[model samples]
Target: MSLHESVLCSTLPSQGTGTLTLHDLQTGTPLALFKHTSSSSRCVAVIPTRAGLGGVAIAAQVDKAVLNVYSFQKDQVLLKCVLPERLACTAVDKRGLLCAGGTAQGRIYLWEKLASGALCNVWDAHYRQVTTLAFSHDGDALVSGSDDAGISVWSVSRLLDGDAQNTPVPLLNFSDHTLPITDVVVGIGRFPSCRLVSASVDCSVKLWDFSTNTLLTTFLLPRPISHVVFDATERLIFAVANGPEGDIYQVNLLRRRDDHVEAVGGAGVNDIIRLGMENKNEQDPASGKISVGEEVTVLSLSLTSSLLLAGTVAGFVHVYDVHSHQRLRSISVGAKITNVYAMLRPPDLFGHTSLVAREGSIPVRPIAPLQRTRATEWEGKEVGVLLAPFGKETAESLINYPSDELQRDFALLLHTSPSNVREEPATATNARVAELEAEISHLRGQLGRAKGVNDAMWEAMVRKVVAQEKEKNNADEGRIKKKGKKDH
Candidate 1:
């Protein structure tokens, strides 16, 4: 039996069609989903304010021109704001301030929240279509990468332009990347202060030391990149790419004493369902004794990197030993898996929520564009679907099913499959990789100019743009209403 056979499964309402489902990983249940009502909800980010601060936020893009905000309670749509026409990307600060990008325009929108919990201001600070957005750990600033081949930083406090002698404050724009930036993430552990890592369509993941606003290192990917993320504790960085064939890779980033960089292949190129942190290995400093623990991918991993918890695209969430890459046990959500959202709950429980699995529909952006008629049919299927695997309840659900005996037999067979191991590629090729690294450097240098503007000036420009757009939308609505009245 395969791993799928041993796991129990259940279906969630194919959530709202076209929505991104974020499950509470700690409880192993669906928490909230950010759905695209008109266009598409590209990304969903949940930033938890300090514990007991009583605020957690979720932000998602809608129609490429608007971002919707929902509190953790999943109640009340907190904010809705229009942005540039084509919002290709979005990200949020720890305090729930939002940053978003547009295509062709290379502009980044900086959204701030008022003390009264309302959206305070919006600014257009970039000169090109922004592709990726990241925020400092402290939420004091935001980082934006654009197709214009530049990464720009905006100070959140600078929203109050008068503080700097009543002069308009300019955003710190860093011009790099010959190609469009695909993804950006703040540093996890050792490189903590305002450090960030960004991956580009140029097939490179570059680390930036924000304190200096300069590139620290550039790492290569096996193919054109798709998405990138950091491990729970930030000890590891993972990137995925689209290949001619169906292949994916999970690589680890490491720094060498010679100032050279290496992209060690830590996980193999199978269609990676989800990349997350697992298993934290803690060691005693005095005796150098190592304590091995469960390999669970939790929202936060331990200092030793021994415990990790992550859900998969296969509808199963596993808590396993990272060193051994062994599945301690797995829970299968009945639906094909999408994304996993992990949360921490009570003392013994850790939530591992799985998103709607990717099946039937192809990823929105394929490397090679197919003709309209040749695209996969996504019309009939329900959207926003997810599977949540319960712990004992999952086991019991299977055991009590009408076909309990068949389920038990299937479980036994899974216990016997060739171990269902996950393999990693070797890291032996560094020289040729470095040569390619040089090519990547050349690309980053060949990008165009990215202009910066004063925060106040940009804010005023955006407010005017938003007001005009709102009026146009209202006028269109009025015309539609008049037509309906006439027909009636």
Candidate 2:
């Protein structure tokens, strides 16, 4: 089946029967839909599994104490497990190794090696009800926010160290905001380079570098920020303010005061961009922004398509172009959307959780159900869970490998026929194969420009490396000549 480059998922919270829907990132086409009773704000996280199908989403159901693991490809709930506490927000690492949830009582619960619930830890990570939670880029740290206006970064490695007598304290804590925090976004950088952006009811967004344990910059806005989101590149940030006539604010991380600042309309800060304000950009209708009303509940961004999704309480999701400030598509979901998650979905993954092999496709492995690690008296306190690998693993699906076989395969496929070179007798299989071949042909037609850019970048990097090596050789030769003259 042909799938879009990314998937946009949202859940209805206030309806009599909660609904979960996944749509194409750009066209807003429904990919999958199902009825799910559990819902909450910031409740769903769709992650990419090793298997190509829709990776499992860790969804926190508000009406009940259990969380539902939904498989996007299968369009069904994989598992529903009871939680130790009532969770308000939940997050999973990119590797799907850990599942973190924030409880209404202001505690953070982490299940490490999710398949083996054995590595469970709970800590009082906040003062009031926890509002949001996010895993750091490397998944080595977890960032949690609470209604008490506190943001804490917890070290995952240290927590699992298990040598300490008591629970470990957070790696760092920022108590700058005075009101409840609505959302937090962690960049894909480690150590001193890592940045954490947060929005709160205090009408301000603060950027912090956890490594130095200090605030980097604060962007004060006109109204309270209801949601904050970072694109895949993290170059731009989208922060939505609450209330009627609320406009979406765009903040550029790479920009400085030196920039011309022509794109934004009367921005309060050089780095913070004010988008789509009708009063200021009246002459340029395209410059004007969409006035997302107070009822807007969920906001998700697709960097691939440069589209911003705004889900409102009135059961409508409006897609707006971030660059042109034009509304692209509006989807009427017919219910209040409380939880929404947008992610890049990989192609041709497994059809189900069973890891059944399909023709001309590879199965992306899914994480197994949560289990406990039992400690025996003989082993004392050090208990470890061992994962015995059992699943379909394709040689090409492996991201990290020492062999250049993938490069060779790419080159070989260039001359290969567009259709599956293998002849098949079945009509349904042939039709599916033909459809895939046409999709491949269409993609290759568009890949020329992108492929050129990609090759240019690679060649440029290779040339730089070659030049550095040449310089090093020249320096060594000059040193040898000087040494020989000294010896003579």
Candidate 3:
């Protein structure tokens, strides 16, 4: 009962059918397609069970309020558990002993796996609809994100250790986002200091130091980010923007510009490096140009960190080579791809392969353990920098100063008039005037070029309007002729 490497795609069927298809990653062939009686079942997470026997727990939303857990083994559902809540998001622990889900009413339910494939000890958590969830690699903490733009870190041990009747408080809480959180991933190995990354419809991704409840950095994107995943090394973040023309972008976490403010509160702004654009000329003519703005609904990263999978609302799954930024293949599942999971074959232990895992095999870089006192000291400095004024100089002096001498002299001696100053050498003054005149001429040339572009754009718009009017008139004339023929 060894689990093989595969990809699971949950689809929204066009004709009142919902399906969960398992495809072999090597051959891109469907191994099995599990069709549901309900038309809108969206399979969310495929997690390995902890029962010593190789099995998978498939969580799917059968409807708005009912989540169906199908225990799958050898391409068949052996057991089923129905959770009575409208679940919006779910996550399973690494050991598969516990499962967490967020509901529409902003409650979180933690279901511990029992001996006979039953889920029990449901714990209520959160005050808003949970939108995303992730389990820390060590399986000690569970992180949940909700529509309230809040993230809560729950202790796994406390939830399972204490009485089921008591509601556990979050270990840490974060509320930096102003919109619904779209995805969350906990850092592992090198990032063992409890680092969490979250993406949101606010068009920003934030890196949080969960140990101290402080935001380390924020990455802003052009459009709302719907999904985010860490690369194999955890040094880069791959995110999918939400829109018809939404693109996949790779953000380098370690790279920061020198001009970037290193303060905690002020985030460093960097451009998203676009990746994996399929060549339009090489694609199928029938498919056209991928529709102008098809939204990317889901994203998954391969275990090797070399490949990326993006599922679109247009019913196409695009595979990309991460390093080359090229689309390797475009799989059309004939339905909207709601979710995609990359199931990596587990590493051989004592010559026996265990269950599958989602993360890659790349070794994590060793990062020094974060010091709490150092972090606190830096936070104070950041606040000081944010609150500090620009300078003591007047606004006019600050605005007019162009050189070091002017900044120092004019700014300090604001009461002194410029006309009373000593004159410069005649040649130097002439040279300065000439330089200023040359700059003005160059600016005028740029303005002329800009005006030309604006005029061209205006003319194009006018022509388009005229063409639309002509088409409407032709349609009206055709209707009038048809009416005359009928009257006759």
Candidate 4:
């Protein structure tokens, strides 16, 4: 697939009734669009691995009480883990370990893929439903946020060392939420310097400097934060919340302007208190400028924080350019997109949650456009949406056709073969391939004249590839004809 096509979303059709569809952010095309076969999926996580750079998303089924894992590489379920009951939530570490929190019960189970290609690690922790889980950058700690409004940080190595019958003590239990804690994260950096951030239903995001075992900052949001993430630079804390109007906020933690330190610890000035700094409207001591409207509900932050992505029940994923504070783009997932997740790969990754994949390009041919209904007349009932991945052009076209229309389109696509080599004289095919390769070589030279990957470069690359493939086909046909003559 061309870089453009690779970014487009492609749907995988399934006969199941309980399907969950994911549209690719690049092409706005359906990527592995499917529903749960047995029941509604309770939780899903994307995992990226070397097996393929793409992600493998795991879905927990409430009715089946089993976890289904799939990679974009294949349609079949890669693995399944039977659970004691329905899982409320799940998280995948960078290394591909899968963990789930029980729904009705308050236990957390750790799962690992065994050498035999089966899932292992069946156990539980916590006294209640675990709503959120995050693995530290080092893979040493696993933190979970729960309905209890308490955040617990656990030692992954220690958990693995425990016997099947032994219970473990939590490294730290930061229980201070008046309401439920919705999300938790361990800051990135060297060991012994890790920090933790927690979002609460109480409308605040708390930063805990774990080294000091104290709360670093108490950030009150414009609305109750549904999610929180560190920006690409890790200096800015991003958050998402619910309000009458949809908005996202960024919190700058490095500014010493909020430097009023009141000790909250016992017996001495042991703990630092940076109060009155909660609201950004306060005057900054450094620049002496009063800031306003700095708080935002963070929906999702890119892995590196180069971009801040947020979504609200209002059905839009707002992409902020970060440093510029400029609105880069807004992606409309259409149906009230309840959750907006950032996978290393495109949102349509079917297999693992991560985005790294090596081989195989799932070609998705566009379907015919459907008519707009009265309700969708606002957007012209167009089957396609423009994606703002970087440079602004209608780079991708999403085909959200009706089921009947999709069937017809799928059949039509099957007839269009990828242009490569052609069926003709071997010498002629070889010459065509050489010419196309030479053209691609020349295009590489022209790249030095441009500043970025512009449309011209993309067009040239696509044309070159198509030509090469056609030439390859022709050479294969020539070889077959030669064999036929020998038989004669």
Residues 1-488, candidate 3: write the lDDT tens digits: 22245677888766675677767665577656666622222237665422223335455454655454443433444344555655677777776666676667877666654322223335556566777788898888888888788888887777766564566788888887889888898877422475777999988888877656777777776678888888756776877777777566666665445867233332322323322344444233221122224678788876666678888778877877666566777777778788888874322111222213233121111111111111212222311011113653322222232454553444323324556555476899899999999999999999999999999999999999999999999999999999999999
How many residue pairs clash per model? 40, 10, 8, 58
lDDT, candidates in the order shown: 0.45, 0.68, 0.62, 0.54
Q: Which stretches of candidate 4 lie over 4 Å from their true place?
A: 1-32, 37-42, 51-54, 62-64, 75-80, 98-102, 114-124, 256-298, 344-488
Candidate 1, residues 1-488, lDDT tens digits: the string is 11121111112224443333443332345444444422222244545422222233334344345555544333445566554354665566654444333445654444333232222234455566666676777766667777667777766667533232343244565555678776677764332365676777877766666666566666665455655656554546545454433222334454355777754333422222222223323231222111223221111222234433443334455544444444455544544333333433211111212111222211111011101111133346232222334442321132122444445544433343333333232453566688899998877665422223356678899999999999999999999999999999
Of 1 and 2, the candidate ranking higher by lDDT: 2
Among these predictions, the greatest lDDT belongs to 2
Question: Candidates 1 and 3: which is better by lDDT?
Answer: 3
Query: Which ten residues in a row are the worst by lDDT in model 2?
Result: 371-380
lDDT for 127 (candidate 2): 74
Question: Runs in model 3 with CA error above 4 Å?
Answer: 1-4, 37-43, 49-52, 69-76, 114-124, 163-165, 190-192, 256-293, 345-488
**What's the C-alpha lDDT at position 84 in model 3?**
64
A best-first ranking of the candidates according to their TM-score comes to 2, 3, 4, 1
Q: How well does each candidate superpose onto the true structure, as a TM-score?
A: 0.48, 0.69, 0.60, 0.57
Error of 2 at 141 (Å): 1.0
Candidate 4: residue 454 lDDT (0-100):
79
